[model samples]
Target: MTILVEKPVLALEPKDVSNKDDSEKEMAAKNGFFAPEINSFGNSFRDYNAESARQSTVEEFYRLQHINQTYNFVKRMRAEYAKLNRMEMGIWECCELLNEVVDDSDPDLDEPQIMHLLQTAEAIRKDYPDEDWLHLTALIHDLGKVLLLPQFGGLPQWAVVGDTFPLGCAFDDSIVHNKVAKQNGTTLPPAALFIIRFHSFYPLHTAGAYKHLLNDEDAKSLNWLHIFNKYDLYSKSKDKIDIEKVKPYYMSLIEKYFPAKLKW
Candidate 1:
């Protein structure tokens, strides 16, 4: 009897990734070309180490995303994750889980996963107070990245993390025009990324589909996206930002959108 060969982590098919259970999904999720979030947890990197350097020419990422991410794909994914059935948990655990995405490949400062998240949130909370949701938004925007962990949701890097864009249509060049979405072959899914970029409320405003996704909450919170975007991407500095110095401020923001402790 003849059998078919299935591709492994380095060359996974979308269907292959989707079929996995939490354990198998976790295994596949840590493929590590950049930093896969699917199988990660609180202590994955406690015994820290260094990583290598690699990047892509900006040209390739746009080419495929522009072609593959049609409007239909966006609608389909939004419909799927919006069910919230994939993982109905609390926000704090989700946030903690997202830290696995600290791309060791960058060969830069080895910031722990949680510190990067705090940097973005604290940076915004400093400047924007009236928009309470904006502070919470910064905290949770990357929570979808937790999907890379089996404990949370165990989705692939493409499904739950990375530079999110509008999936139902063409890829935008402005998001992040190099390396990852190029050599890695996928980016965040339309649903989580779309929700992070938008929330279904009022809006600060951007071009194309960005303006349309806001609900009252989304509109209220999106301002932080603008604030966090700078530090989240560019602020991966050589020095680690101190998390203790900043937690109380974010604790206040957490109290605003979520309860004192999250369920997940």
Candidate 2:
């Protein structure tokens, strides 16, 4: 399906170094290339280094995530959440709700969750202007993190945010939190769902691990996931987005792929 999305008037411009703090300047310098280098904190993106203050808390979050995110726990959470009874709201409403959320598990960003979502979607939109479904996919990919909110059962950060891996299989070494634990397309294509579900499964896509667990369909979906990962991981920055200016554009895309209101 060809989704019609109005391009927002406020383009996401490059950060002006003159206005940035020392750390932000350093980060902007590192992000000079398509694939940026270590973060401004001088730690690799998602580094989780034991001694680095910026990464240490993230490491601890992973420690808890690794121990608790077992097959049974995943299964139970799926069963409970699959009911979709938390609340009913439009996709944009959910996006606005994320303005109050922060991902404690992320080492790269401390901003509100909506910024990351918009940043990723806008970055992908700029590069793949014709792929409106991909743009919408990027916007809603992390809507699942709404589980962290009180109305959604108030799940801990470990349960909602952070990199995700498969529960039925062994954790792969390439996954960032290995030391601790562990998509869609056009009208929200099947490929887009695959990317949203498994982007954090770095072992399968990035590391060439876990081939044994994937069937033929999964193998095919892996290709799109690889393409999606670049924008998802590398689009993050210290730059702020003007939500009021961009909200109309994303709201249009959300209307295309999803109902006005979705079950939580």
Candidate 3:
């Protein structure tokens, strides 16, 4: 499919990034984005070892996830959800459905799934206003979490959301872009698809794992994913987005990139 996207009004010039610890904050500031110093829990972002009430719950969830997310198990999940036989709904409808879900593995966010989606998208939109495709990509990236709903088999939290990584010989799982949007015939660019598919892959993007596995295309996609990941990780707060106000804007993007109704 030929995906149409907006041309950036100003091409970002590459900068010689300093190895200083505050590089990320400096970069965000340069790009007209602000990176908060702490997360909603008054802890640093993605600090899994932080002492908090949610710490034990997050650790336990990871324990279960590591144990059960085996190669064979992921294969089964891929085949099962590839069917996309769950139901037909538009992007907005799926977003509404996700409001009932939350990610137990996310130490930074305990908000409903929809809030994170909007938070991430709005943050990106503010910083990169010309990138409409990116805004929509952020919005729908976690729609696959609907698998946790009863109508979609009510999958366990461990299986549905977390920092995704490979268990098999190669990387493949029932991620949003891999199993949902691509299967449903989305015309989003490869970069948008990459962000949708691997935004939770903290080890690769954040910890610098699996760098050797990246090809030329994966390398290019990783740059965009890196930019997207910051907002996805840090935008989680008690702040509320006015859904009714932003609905029309995202709906227009949805109509541009996706069919009115999709199979699950």
**All candidates' TM-scores?**
0.51, 0.81, 0.85
User: Tens digit of lDDT per residue, candidate 2, span 207-251?
Assistant: 888788788878777776776787788777787889999989988
Give the lowest summed-lDDT range of ten residues in model 3.
Answer: 172-181
Clashes of each: 18, 10, 0
Taken over the whole model, the C-alpha lDDT of each candidate is 0.44, 0.75, 0.80
Worst 10 residues of 1 by lDDT: 7-16
Q: In the order shown, what is each candidate's alpha-carbon RMSD?
A: 18.7, 7.3, 5.8
* Winning candidate number (TM-score): 3
Across residues 95-122, which tens digit of lDDT does each residue of candidate 1 receive? 6565566533222324555766665565
Which should have the higher TM-score, number 2 or number 3?
3
Query: In terms of lDDT, which candidate is stronger, 2 or 3?
Result: 3
TM-score of 3: 0.85
